[model samples]
Target: MGRKVALGGILTAISIIFLYLAVYLPSAKLTMYFLTGIIPGFILVEMGARQAWLLYFATSMLSFLVLGNLVNAVPYIFIFGIYPLIKYYIEKTRNILIELTLKLLFFNIASLAVYFIWTRVFLINITIAFPIVWLVLGLQFAFLVYDYVFTRVIFYYWDKIRVYWRKDVR
Candidate 1:
């Protein structure tokens, strides 16, 4: 329990740092935002869903307050931050097709929800800048890339990194 708390604290600190960097570095904002999910991914793999949730929410609230941007934190907190934990359960079915399908479904819905909230509620007219189809296609491709990268990272962490980390922690 102490180890879990310590690890969760580390993950939360890393996530918050990434989010703060996202706010300061406008050009690298997207990359920083995406990277914020990585530590939570590690927590999800090493600990469990409950601890991952704790770390995620801690980062979300800190990002919201420190960064002062609910928009920035929404997608991460609602979807990307917790994806690895969700994927752990999804992959238990032992069917690649089911796993991919569910992952895509979650990605698409979360993407659309963020888009809806931004465009409709906030009235951020993106139509004048980019067509809707183009945006959707971009998000589709982005999710594909994210899914691929996530799988590789998870594999590496579980098979290679976990062994070392577990020894030290134990």
Candidate 2:
């Protein structure tokens, strides 16, 4: 338990630092922008999807008061239109990659579309909205990559933890 707490703190530090790197990304390379913001999201999903969403909401509430940024509602945790599609594929006994791919697709394609439409209708200046949208999307995608990689590796250990045993210590 202590080790997990320490690890969580370390990951949060790394994520905050990477999010700080958002300034380095150029307009044309919006993907990088999304990747940085998603670092924390990735860590959240790794711990627990539902709990991750709660953590995301907490961070988002803070972000709003600090920066007045409303992009936090992009629904990164729940993944719009993705769960159903992935479920369809899973029912067919498809590979895990397919599910991850759908997660990416939902965030990159559907959620972004929703965000863009919302920002366009509400925000007066679409120009200012573009960069923010790009960054949010970039973060979502990056988190997906990290989540997929970490999730697979964690599963490996989780599987082993059940069977591994210590010997000669009696």
Q: lDDT per residue, candidate 1, 1-170, as tens digits? A: 89888888887888888887877788998788678877777887788788878887788778778776667777677677777767778889999899878888888887778778888877777654778788777878888798788789878998888988577654
* Best-fitting candidate, scored by TM-score: 1
Locate the minimum summed-lDDT window of 10 residues in model 2. 76-85
Q: Model 2, residue 60: what's the lDDT?
A: 41
Clash count for candidate 1 is 0
> How high a TM-score does candidate 1 get?
0.86
For residues 43-117, what per-residue lDDT tens digits would candidate 2 score against the true structure? 443454543444444444443354333343233223421232233344355667776666566556665575565
TM-score of 2: 0.40
What's model 2's overall lDDT? 0.46
Tell me each candidate's TM-score.
Answer: 0.86, 0.40
